[model samples]
Target: MKKTIVLVTLFIMPIVVYLFFASGITNFGKLAMLTHDVSEIDFADSNVALADKITVLGFLGSDVSNKKGNAFNLNQKIYKRFGQFKDFQFVMVMPKGTEQSVDDLKAQLGQLSDVSKWNFVFGEEDQIKGLFNSLGTNLSLDANLGTPYVFIIDKERILRGRDDDEDEGVKYGFDTSSVADLNNKMEDDIKIILAEYRMALKKNTAQREK
Candidate 1:
């Protein structure tokens, strides 16, 4: 009986768990793509390597100092957990002349976690607007080329976000100012996307092996 139970638990339970998620009608396990081909902007003074990377993209306004609390929340909730992933990165675009402020912000972020993958790209206001426009999102940049929202960009530069959001109908970006939103929604979505890639990689490897 002991050996039989172990066999059923190891084999049958795996199939049961897989089928449960596979049959989910909402397909909530997978993150939805909101925009396609978010062109990587080359005009930045400091450009992040966007090709073939999973990026958490944001725009920090001219007054980076004011965003300290939001930045800390992101670092603690998102970056700290996912920073170790090979292709995962945080790309924050800032209008030109925010370099010193960004550097200071980085210093503070580094105290919390390894901020190596935290990339800050500097660009003119026009350049920043151009990049943000390519996202094809309903959101708009503030006067200083910043918003309280940030987004998830897949390897192909496509925007991944919630489409059937109960509150917003079509959720485009994660709000930085809301810790509860980040903890409850954004973190889970991040996990899904990362797992999605890992599963794809595993499938590709298995195919190659076969």
Candidate 2:
């Protein structure tokens, strides 16, 4: 009995240590702020004011493929979920040559474009790439084709990541067809940040009154 107990304890000890470190590694921290002091990134329609509101920034390519449309479609789904709120905005940045597709893409909204809330911006390849790098977002884009990641930039221009997702800051491909994982995770994260912001505002107001 004594020998058996000793062997079991040794086996369980390593497992316990492994689980502890794994949880710590996956536990998300507060949203990360910009690595540099450039302030805000400029879009074609508006120079997205960081301190103004929460921004959901997504990227689309000009390639004749589904990746670009997948990212846009995901954005559409996100808008349907939170379009009525004026405090948030979704901006989609695409390659410059595809600007003509704006009309067709707008039809996907099933409503008129709310330029203030839903903006479709474009720029030269270099310009777009520069914006991504400036914000400390890892983007995989080229002259006409690339797979980019979606990022949540808070009011203070901080890049928000998940509290339990290890890859929250890692750039990955967007595929709306499989909406359960990526799309839902992002929507939930947005809600979490919005709630945190509201709570902070309330606290500030109370302090001011006191």
Candidate 3:
């Protein structure tokens, strides 16, 4: 009888673990479904219009304790380099539970004079998760969870590059190196997108002259 009881316990443990992790993945997929295009979202400040061309949006998960992570540095560098592109906009979305407030974030960004050329958006945890989901990226839902993610969206609303951290259609299995390579490739991809936008802008301008 004891042997039977032990066998039953062993059989049930793996099932329980699988279900727990599976549920978390499902929840993330649901959250991702809530994301809408940036053009669809109304920016509180009208001076910064919705990008009509290619846009690069980076997600930085900042904590009050450590404000200088690689994510922050990457954003600062990108802003300093390309913040002035008329057809390209760089947006940084902060994770939830960060010590910084929207105003505080703005103030911190103010230290970088070039930062004024771009827009800084304060994102709610759920909304940001939805954006990740829309890009097909999965982020931890916990209050303090953060991930470094970059997304490139074209004017036609097409999402280019791998969005989710997980392998497509597979649950829980992640390729860390693949994600890192994708992030690195984003800088080059952004340049290509910007060039396309510039060409389109030139075409539009020439047509208007005619």
Compute the lDDT for candidate 3: 0.50
Model 1 over residues 170-190: C-alpha lDDT tens digits?
888999999988987788777
Q: What is the C-alpha RMSD of each candidate to the true structure, in Å?
A: 5.1, 12.8, 19.5
For model 3, the superposed segments whose C-alpha errors exceed 4 Å read 1-39, 42-53, 62-67, 95-109, 138-145, 162-184
lDDT of 2 by residue, 1-210 (tens): 998989879998878745533443344334344443324656576665556678777666676345535645665666666666657887677787776665466655545334447667777777777767656544455556344456677776667664334554453323345566545565555556665676678799999999
Per-candidate Cα lDDT values, in order, are 0.85, 0.60, 0.50
Candidate number of the best lDDT: 1
Best candidate (score: TM-score): 1
| Tens-digit lDDT string for candidate 3 (74-159) | 54555555566766665556654453554565566667654554455655666666655655444453354345445566665555
**TM, every model:** 0.86, 0.68, 0.55
What is candidate 3's TM-score against the reference? 0.55
Best first by lDDT, ranked: 1, 2, 3
- Weakest 10 consecutive residues of candidate 3 by summed lDDT: 170-179
